[model samples]
Target: MTTLTVFYIGLFYIAAIIFFGGLAYRIYEYSRTPAPLNIPTTPAPTTAGGVVVRMAREVVLFESLFKSNKWIWVFGWLFHVGMAVVLLRHFRYFQEPVWFWVEFIQPYGKYASFAMVAGLAGLWARRFMVDRVRYISTPSDHLMLALLLGIALSGMMMTFVAHTDIVALKAFALGLLTFDWHPLPADPVLLAHLTLVAVLMIIFPVSKLLHAPGIFFSPSRNQVDNPRDRRHIAPWAQALERDNA
Candidate 1:
């Protein structure tokens, strides 16, 4: 194996283990930690219809994001759609005899890359140009956006402008999957794109990007807002209490 291959493989394993292990440990610690439940002293929504409307507005319409900043909502939606499309397109790397669906989506992948770059640029621009965003944005936020933009832009260049030998790209990916390391000659542009993607994956679980998973855990979204008189505690929690007693 070439030094480059070895280095990249080592980086991949190290990143995967550390990122996953740390995430697991963090979740374990969070589960063990006791949180004070400040059940709202504020008056609850008087009617079921009102509660349903409010919940629908918050969860479905992203009322919080709209209330905070319309640009945030716009950029956020674009970023997510672009990322999803790009990721799906990457299935070409893994599948031998490139899948028909991948072929079909190739054009969409180009558009997705464009959208991702545009969204990232807009977001970064907002961070600088908007007074509130500038005040609140951290260096990490800027770095993440920059990295994503770099990856998307490089990918776009590879697709539309600077063509790389994608056969070599497939070989390299398959080699990685099969544990048969091959030094496939890839374009520097491709290397930059892959490296940025790797960096994003490594940083993702640790960063605010974790809000992807956090939304499911959100009390407001996941917890049903019914009157305490109407709902009963889960049998599992009651059983656990009985066992403890």
Candidate 2:
């Protein structure tokens, strides 16, 4: 294997392991950490079915955030929805026979970069311009935006500015999946994009990006507002009672 191939293959494997392992650990911890109180946000869903619907609306429409701030909601929605399409489009790279649906959306996904960047720019600007947001914003928050902006811009440059050998890139990606080594296109933008992507994956579970999964564990969102219907007891509190008995 060539040095570049070895380096990337090893780096990807390590990043994959960390990404998945960290997520599993985080998820397990969230599951075990009980919400001792029935603390669902008020004017909230009452039934389990209603909770699911609320969550769906929250995920797809950013309903709550939209009610809070329209501009932030607009930018956040554009970036996230564009990212979903782009990620789906990228599934073609790993598969030997790309799915027909993935192939069909390729063009749309390629251009979604514009929306993604536009949204990120709006969000990044809010950090500088909005006093409350700026006060709470950490260096890591700005750095995360920089990393995402870098990845998206570099990718756009690859697509429109200086196109690389995508065929070779796809082959390299597939080879990594099958343990059959292939040479990567030594394109600087592509390399930079991939490097940023790897860092993003490795840091994702540990970063605020974990809000992706952490949202599922949040008491305000996940808990049903039904204190009258059933008693609420934290697992640790129950355990203490059993020990005393």
Candidate 3:
């Protein structure tokens, strides 16, 4: 293997460790955190089943975002759905036979980058164009958008502009899974795309990107709004009460 291949193998190993490990720890913390009140947002679900349906809507449809702002919802939904399809399409690289769905989406994923980039551009523009958003926006937000944009643009260049050695690339991806460690193509654009992806993974646990998982644990969104029918006691509070008794 070339030095570049060894370096990337090591880099990806580290990035995977940080990404998965850190995300798991953060999720555990969120689970353990207590909600002091039954404070689901108004018009919230009252039953467990209702909460499930509500969460489904929030996750898949971005219901709250849609209600709050149509433009933001459009951009956010476009980015998320396109990125998801692109990721599903990438499963072709890691699997030997490749699932039928993955094969089917290859053509769609080829063009999904355009939607992804367009969505990112719209979102990035919102930061500058909206006064309240601009006031609260930090450097990290801009940096995250730029990083994603870089990855999408570089990927598009590889697809539409300068084709990389995809056979070699797929070998490298499969190698990572099988511990075989194939040599990676020395294409600069491909390298940049992979590097940006790695960077995004490493930062994801610490960044606002945590919202992807954090939404599930949100008190306002996930709580059942039945305080009147049932006494709301936090797990920690219940323990304390038992000890007192």
Q: In model 3, where is the ten-residue run with the lowest total lDDT?
A: 81-90
Superposed on all Cα atoms, the candidates' RMSDs to the truth, in angstroms, are 4.9, 1.3, 1.5
Per-residue alpha-carbon lDDT of model 1 for 179-217, expressed as tens digits? 777675646887788778778778877898777656544
Error of 3 at 222 (Å): 0.8
Segments in model 3 whose C-alpha atoms lie over 4 Å from true places: 239-245
lDDT of each: 0.73, 0.91, 0.93
Which residues of candidate 2, in runs, are more than 4 Å off?
243-245
Give lDDT: candidate 2, residue 227. Answer: 95
Q: Model 1: how far is 117 from its true place, Å?
A: 1.2
Which pairs of residues have clashing backbones in candidate 2?
A: none
The full ranking of all candidates by TM-score, starting with the best, is 2, 3, 1
Clashes of each: 0, 0, 0
Candidate 1 Cα RMSD after full superposition onto the native fold (Å): 4.9
lDDT of 3 by residue, 65-118 (tens): 999999899999888888888888889998989899899999999888888988
Whole-model lDDT, candidate 2?
0.91
